[model samples]
Target: MTETTIPKRGVPLWVQIIIWVFIAALLVLVGITLNKRQQGTVQPGDKIPDFTLPLFSGYEYEGKSEVKLSDFQGKVVVLNFWASWCKPCEQEAAELEEAWQFYKPGGQVIFLGADYVDTEPEARAYLKKFGITFANGPDMGTKISQMFRIRGVPETYFIDQTGELYYVKVGPFVSVNEIKSIVDQKLK
Candidate 1:
């Protein structure tokens, strides 16, 4: 009797390569989805994250030039993230200045502008063009923008007296009254 040799069955090399490619694609998709989900704007009832940036064009904080978010604790903070290159930021600039002047005398509300992703000259020009007299500072490496999870320019975050985020505007504010409305409500 002649002994017959049996061939082992296994996946083909081509099929194994295809499977690995599919797995790699799936992993990439999942990673992208998770990364997007992790980055998000702060919502109401969340505590505003603390940050410090050099004053770009504003009154010096105490004697130091840098502005710290924590320094404005216990006051209503209208924190705005803007860039000079953004048109919406330009549009809302006047309104922000108006609101700043309006509440400045009362000394209860603090308008802090985070000049996001901009150079000093252009940022200064933008502020000068709009005559923004409020405290404006450069975001410097976008640290504050990342902390706020800023999706775009001209985003504003409202913090109540207790240092908790109370409202968020993702785009340029409509008008000075709109800002005043939120600030007034928060002040109360």
Candidate 2:
């Protein structure tokens, strides 16, 4: 019997390269879609998302250990995102603490700090150094940061008494008075 040779059936190099490029593009598109979803779009006049997290530093409110955004409903909420390693956060720490003292006593406002991407020991040290007494907790897996679409540290969000987002401050606040002015407006 005579042996017959079979022809090779291989994909062309150019077609192979094109297929890989298409796959890479598809993967990148998918990544962008997921990223957009993760970075939620929260705007003023919109109801702020509620979250509950364990406080790692600062005071526990009303004999409860965990801090919940919903707990402060019908009250103005100052939600601040910060990290121990961020200098701007350090600069505004005093201002935040002062605001906390002023409003906390009135029972019409609540200041909560979301310590973003930081270790507990370092965060506690930062709070201690800054003399921060407001409720502060780690953002645990950065869930809160993603919800707020935080771009950097020292970002502050003010929620009105009705639980609607009123304003967003993206950097270190000038003074406690400045924050109080906004809080006063929201209170009204």
Candidate 3:
């Protein structure tokens, strides 16, 4: 009778390596998904994400090249997302400027315009047309919109003094009072 060697009882080396690789990939995918979910969208009462926005030509704040959300720690922020081609944005353009002017003297509130999906020349012209004097900047690759998960143009986010989101307006404001109503409430 010949003595036969016993066969290995465990998984083959190649099979085990493949399984570990697949498991690692799965873990990485799950991690990425969770991270995206955490930063996906902001809502009322949630802290808004901080971002540095490069001001467009002639829109700098305090002569600075860019502005960061964290820079205004104790001030209410009126952040508006608009596009040069948006008709609804045009409707509220002057109203927003009026509201900005109304709050500018107080120094407790700041208005920030984030131009979305527009050429610099057109954005500048739109600002000039509306006579916008507050700090305005380009979104630059739509990063700001992505942070807020904006559905469309003309969306505005009212951030309270504590840096939490106070309100969200999906459409353009109809009047200066309409814009002021929200900012005024946030000021409180």
The better-scoring model by lDDT among 1 and 2 is 2
Q: What is the lDDT of residue 40 in candidate 2?
A: 55
Q: Write the per-residue lDDT of candidate 2 for residues 13-80, one digit (tens) a residue.
A: 99999999999999999999898877554778888778887787345666567877888888999989
Stretches off by above 4 angstroms in model 2 are: 1-41
Candidate with the greatest lDDT versus the true structure: 3
lDDT of 2 at 141: 85
Give candidate 1 regions above 4 Å deviation.
1-39, 57-59
Give the whole-model CA lDDT for all candidates, comma-separated: 0.85, 0.86, 0.89
Better of 2 and 3 by lDDT: 3
**Candidate 3's error at 63, in angstroms?**
1.5
Considering summed lDDT, which 10 consecutive residues are worst modelled in model 1? 56-65
* Whole-model lDDT, model 2: 0.86
Please give, for residues 5-72, the per-residue lDDT of candidate 1 as tens digits. Answer: 89889899999999999999999999998997786887899987778878863544445688777888
Clashing pairs in 3: none
Best by TM-score: 3
Record all residue pairs in model 1 with backbone atoms less than 3 Å apart, i.e. clashing: none
Q: For residues 57-116, what per-residue lDDT tens digits would candidate 3 score against the true structure?
A: 688898997999999999999999999999999999899888888888899998999999
lDDT of 1 at 70: 87
